[model samples]
Target: MVTAIIMLSVEKKHINQVAEKLASIKGLSEVYSVSGPYDIAAIARVQNNDEISELVTQHLAQIDYILKTETMLAFKAYSKDDLEGMFSVGA
Candidate 1:
């Protein structure tokens, strides 16, 4: 799966509403109200790079209240589960 971290800058009054709407998008897996230069961070997982484009263009672009968005493509995944398995090898 291809995973994207989408950072959003939304109109101050529409942050919560936009977060709720974003959570419902087909490929988006998680939505968060965060503190930073961006107001929201959303995680989207899909089948390929093209799906990422579709999610941004077809789905996200339709939200009128979103002021700006920055999408980052993940090249690798590392987690606690992966670390445990790797350290246990031949032990």
Candidate 2:
């Protein structure tokens, strides 16, 4: 799975609206209204890199409330399975 974090910069007045709209998209997992240079942050898991482009262009960019966005792709993840295996003393 390809995991991506999309940081959205929205107009102050449109923060909630933008977050709500983001929630409607299929791949988007979570959306948070944040306090920082960006107004909102979201996490998504996609099937491939191409879908990222489609998500950014076709979905996100079309939202009037979203002014800009920054995306970070994760190459690896630390899951509960990883932790469990690491801490296990014996089989």
Candidate 3:
């Protein structure tokens, strides 16, 4: 799976409504209201890069209240369970 982290700045009055809309999108895994330069954080897991492109430029662009977005592609995720699993392969 391809994972993308999308940070969004939305119109203040529409923050809640925009978050709800993001949660309903098919490839989006989670939506959060956050504190920072961005108003919302969205995690999307999809089959490939093409879907990520379409999701941002097509689906997300269609939302009326989103002011700006920054998308970052994840290279790897580190976790204790995953690390342990990798080292325990022969045990």
The alpha-carbon lDDT assigned to residue 19 of candidate 2 equals 90
Query: Residue by residue across 9-82, what tens digits does model 1's lDDT show?
Result: 99999999999999999878799999989999999878789999999998999997999999999888877566
Reference-based lDDT, each prediction: 0.89, 0.84, 0.92
Residue 79 in candidate 3 has what lDDT? 64
**Where's the lowest-lDDT run of ten residues in candidate 2?**
82-91
**C-alpha displacement of 91 in model 1, angstroms?**
33
Model 1 misplaced regions, further than 4 Å: 82-91
Clashes of 1: 0
Candidate 3, which ten residues in sequence have the lowest lDDT sum? Answer: 82-91
Please write out the lDDT profile of model 3 over residues 1-91, one tens digit for every residue: 6889999999999999999999999889889999989999999888799999999999999999999999999988766566335434555
Q: What lDDT would candidate 3 get against the real structure? A: 0.92
Error at 43, model 2, angstroms: 0.6
For candidate 3, the per-residue lDDT at 81 reads 67
